[model samples]
Target: MFLRLSPRHGSRLLTRIYSAVAARRCPSCSAPLPTALPTCPSCSHIEPLPSTLSYHDIFGLPSVPNPFCVNTQTLKARFLQAQKICHPDAWSGKGKKEHDIAAAQSALLNKAYQTLLSPLQRANYILAQQGLSESETDRLGDTELIMEVMEAREELEEATSGEAVELARQRNRDRINRTQKILEKLIGERRWDDAKKAAVELKYWETIENAVKDLE
Candidate 1:
């Protein structure tokens, strides 16, 4: 069964887990590290992996919906806190070990922000997390729906001749809304099988959106 986590609780758990893993000693020499350091400066020994990291820790979030459901204000505060602690500038004039750790952590945090902020990417990330990737069977089943989107896309693609361009653009926008509604319904119903089908059709709608932009 898939376990669900509230964004607030999940973020706190991830932060605590990462902070604990970040607090460690050099494995080889048994020397303690500074509280701020994620790795030992002297031995260059790596620590065990943390249980959780940011959403971008692995390209995006797992199958959890509401990827941006985390309290925006709280997330902003936590991001600033992370920057203060893990920003590479803090390690200036420090040894390579500290610098590298700071840089790596900073990069991960930035990635998390980017992935969580984007809706489409977040959806793809969630699906991947569920071990439910885009598949051929999903595509085939949704072909009729996809064909509708594909036809619209082709119309937009071929609209360069006249005022048809404007008509195509408006149609594309309308489809975008309709496609979103379908996907939302499928996900809300936890119909993964159908969700995948909707996802495939949405991809075609997205393609039409992109293609129509060229007409403008």
Candidate 2:
């Protein structure tokens, strides 16, 4: 007979398995790293273990296409922790190689945080990870979407009053929301072609939104 474990027990089992499979150790002093801590306690080393960890891994997020459900508070906290560890100033007394590594890691962490912070950017990052290219994304062939964006821009350009402009802005925001849902569905299905097209269409709507803001 198979025994089902409780949630707490399952979580503990997963943690133990992860620890055994991918435990991090300090490169400086070869000490095991505590959860989410940046430095080695034994040697006071400020650098993290050297590994090709993805952005999701760096942020302790699930490796999924839609990171929209990520908690903003948790993301901010993790980003601050990582920055504190990888900041160049923290490595001032270290050697040149270590300092350089710290700077590079800090830059990467910043990029990851910024990318995942914005829904559109996170979608684009997911597409890129799936081997989609800018040129492919730019070559959007959805005639209906193209016409809709054109009409929206024309509406924005012809608006004469603040109310009209606000209405246009609201319409664009609605379009963004709709397109984001489509993108999310496509990504969930691993439909890279359709997802890229949706992402490009969303970019156009975003540009329209910004233009409306300028008019306001």
Tell me how far the alpha carbon of residue 102 in candidate 2 is from the true structure, in angstroms, after superposition: 1.2
Cα lDDT listed for each candidate: 0.59, 0.74
Candidate 1 runs further than 4 Å off: 1-51, 54-85, 135-140, 161-163
Candidate 1, residue 33: Cα displacement in angstroms equals: 19
- How close is every model to the real structure, measured as TM-score? 0.59, 0.77
Candidate 2, 1-216: lDDT as tens digits? 987999766765655444344446765777876534345546757544334455666767765555445666888888897787678898878888778877887888898899888777888888887798556338558787678888999999999999999999998999999988888788888888888888888888988988977765
- Clash tally for model 2: 0
Which pairs of residues collide in candidate 2? none
Give candidate 2's TM-score. 0.77
Q: How well does candidate 1 score on lDDT at residue 6?
A: 98
Residue 67's C-alpha lDDT in candidate 1?
41
